[model samples]
Target: MTIGVIGGSGIYEALPLENVSTKSVSTPYGEPSEDVTLGELGGKEVAFLPRHGEDHQHTPTGAGYRANIYALKSVGVDRVISTNAVGSLREELPPRTLVVPDQIYDRTKHRTPTFFGEGMVVHMSFAQPYCPEMVGHLAESAREATDADVSEDGTYVCIEGPQYSTKAESEFYREQGWDIVGMTTIPEAKLAREAELSYATVAGVTDYDVWKDDSEVSLEEVLENAEANQESINAVIEHAIRTMPEDFESEAWSALEGTINTPTDAIPSETRERVDLLAGSYLD
Candidate 1:
């Protein structure tokens, strides 16, 4: 029942992975964002990968998404809790807030969003994209773990970035009721589903974007809030892992069984070989 946690922005390094071990994984899709740190947390086995690499070298769009998800799957990680630093769109969820987003609206472009490509294709349901049960457990953890106001559920809008959105785009997101905005999470969530892993995001709100009338959202302010919020995020994670039930096998891993829709015969040999570690249950 090992769980994987992909630490996103301002989380370039995870608290020293206890009982540390290092694993270099090769995925059918290619290499992951970085080497994975395998260790013990809450007396349970766990794996952690820094999404932006150890030095935060990769941008959101530059993240090796397919490989990152595949590496987790390769290590027997059945569920993932991705953490990201996002800009708060709502006033109540201002800087230093924590949100466990239950839904996502994708606005990203130029990235592979699924594993079924080449000779195989599968259309999976994303109606309830993030895993509900997992999300509930996380929300509870955040509430009990920190003093930071934790929004139980929120809509996370994922946009292509290297550049923040224009004021018009930000306002449009507000109109659609988006709570936070970020550059990652879409294909990460999508690929997690394709891998049949229960996935959810614990987003750390670091700023009120430029849309805030009186406040100027600057990188300095974002960094300041992000630094302030890290301790709380760490608390939530530690507490969540400590209280995580021992039956992750039955609940979280079950999704991996029938979720793959690609027909066996139709799957290309190369793709199968490349993803053997991940899709072995269905392909083998």
Candidate 2:
């Protein structure tokens, strides 16, 4: 019954850890963001991984989405809290604010985003991409842990980029009414559901996305703001781990319940081996 914490930009170290030790795990997909750091936080067991490499080696598209999620699941982590740095599309949600976004709009183009493929076909529910249990627990923790105000709900717009959005692109997103924008959440959120894990993201607003004529987005600016807000971000996660709901379960996912399209016996042996940890029961 361990909880997983995936650290994003300007957040590579796992805070408030006790009895910390780094554990290396290799999944069928490959190695997770570096090694999984096993430790105790908030009276519960935890597995922490840097979403990008230790030196911030991977970009959003370059991060190991499948391997990262798979490594956590393999270590018996059924629930996850992912942290990200985002640009605010609306002025209502200002920079340095913490947000638990309830909705997601994917505009990303280059990522696999799933663990199931090959001879077997499995479909997952995307209606509520983030887990309700996670959202509730995360919000409760943020209220007590951070001095800053935490937005309970908002819509996240995911883009494919190492580059920040252009002014025209940023303006268009505002017209679409998206609350926040970032690069990594699409497939990371999508793959968590496919693996039958409860997942949520805590987005820290670092800029206004170049839409505001007075302000423009830049990596140097994003990193500076993110560093300023790291203490609050770290506190929310440490407290959230102590408050996670005990009854949280992924068994209610109907799309994952019986949605395998291929006949169990007909799945190719190689394909079965690759996805055995993911949808093996359906293929068996």
Candidate 3:
């Protein structure tokens, strides 16, 4: 029962661990952003993957969400803890604040958000996007490791972006009372639900989005805040790994029992082997 850690933006370097080995995993979806680094952290086995390539080569839209999650699931990672750097939509969630968003408002226009494609069809309940148990564990670990402002829950507005939001767009999100804005959470959260893995995000507030009349958001500001908060983020991940339970039950795992719509005989031979580990039990 290994744990998975996905590093966002400024967190490209591998998590600090002892006895680490990098492994490459192939998934039906495609190649993951980077090789999975397997190692021991706080007496627990863990795997780490950088969402963007180590050099930040992948754009938000180009990040292989399906392959990444599939690779982790294939390697037996039952739960995932991801770290993201995002713009704040609310004034109080200023730079360097830590947020564990409970909900995601997906405004992303491009990207495949599921694994049951090809000839297969499936539906996953995403009403509660993030895993509740994982959220609590992440938040508690963050609080114990950092003195920075940490929030347990908020509405994360996920947008399609290789470009930052326009002022009007930022203002619109604020009007909707969303707590944070970012480019990566949509399919990442959505796909995790389908994979039946407990997933949680630890978002580091970088800047107030362009909506803030007092100050315009800038790359420099975002980078600076992200750099400052990176240590705290790492601490929370290490702590969470240290204390995580070995086994757990969730509606997420149970929900997969009936989600597969394609018949075993109807599926192509290649497709069945490709997706078997994820949804094979439900098929004939």
Candidate 4:
């Protein structure tokens, strides 16, 4: 089984996967952000993809959430661990902290957030939103690798952005009990579920959102923290890969079962072949 790591923002490069090689791939959805880096990590074959193009040209809305997940699935990835840079919503969850969020509250408005389209439709169960088993592994790995305080349970608010939040908006999220805020993750997580890949997020908190009166957020600050904390993040990922069990169950894996709303006879043969990696068993 191949594992996938979707690196966000500053994490364009992963800790050198042993015997690494890069391969560009195409999926029915579109091109992925960049060529997938394939290599071995902790004796397991792993695939790595950068959410944004190598130059970070794609905006959050422009990132092809559908194509990205599909590309990973195409390459035999059954589970994915996504890294995100987030803004802190609560005071206690300060800047430079690490969090493994268990839930996501989507506030994104403009983005292609689903794989089902045209004649296809699906209703996926997202009660937990994240893979609990994966989150638990990440939490333990983070604690072992970093001295920075890491929280196990958090509610992430995903916003539509190339812009940071307004004070009122930030405060509103805090009122909703969200621990962190970011512009990505929701659609990517949702699409992964649709693709039948177990997905989890390891969020790196860069700054206090607009809710903090003491200091405002900035791109420079975000980049700086991401750079400083990367070593710890890499360490955690390596440890997680090393200690990951040979086999485990993920409720996220079964999320798409019985959720397809379209009749099988109505599905186009071309789309079926393209998506066989995700739903071959169900379709058969």
Worst 10 residues of 1 by lDDT: 8-17
Candidates 1 and 2 compared: the better one by TM-score is: 2
Per-model TM-score on C-alpha atoms? 0.93, 0.95, 0.95, 0.95
The digit string of per-residue lDDT tens for model 1 on 55-124 reads 7898899889999998998888888888888988998987888999989999998888987777765666
Mind giving the per-residue lDDT tens digits that candidate 3 earns over 117-224? Answer: 778878767888999888888999999988989999999999999899999999999999899999988799888888888898999999998987887888899889
lDDT of each: 0.82, 0.84, 0.86, 0.84
Give the worst 10-residue stretch by lDDT in candidate 3.
Answer: 8-17
* Model 2: per-residue Cα lDDT over 1-284, one tens digit each: 79888885344364767898988888878777789888887678898888888878988998998999999888888888999999999888888999999899999998998787787787666888888778877887888988887898889999999888988899999999889999888898888888888889888899999999899788899989998778888888888887766766664233367778778787788888877777765554
Can you write out model 4's per-residue Cα lDDT over 1-284, one digit (the tens) per residue? 68898985344365657897888888878889988888887788888888887778899999878888988888889888888899999888877789999999999999887777666677878888888999999999999977878999889999999999999999999898889999889799888888888889888889998888897999999999877768778877778877778887887777778988888889888777877777777777
Cα-lDDT of candidate 3: 0.86
Name the Cα RMSD for model 1. Answer: 2.1
Residue 113 alpha-carbon offset, candidate 2, angstroms: 1.2
RMSD after CA superposition, every candidate? 2.1, 1.7, 1.6, 1.5
Best by lDDT: 3
What is model 4's C-alpha RMSD?
A: 1.5
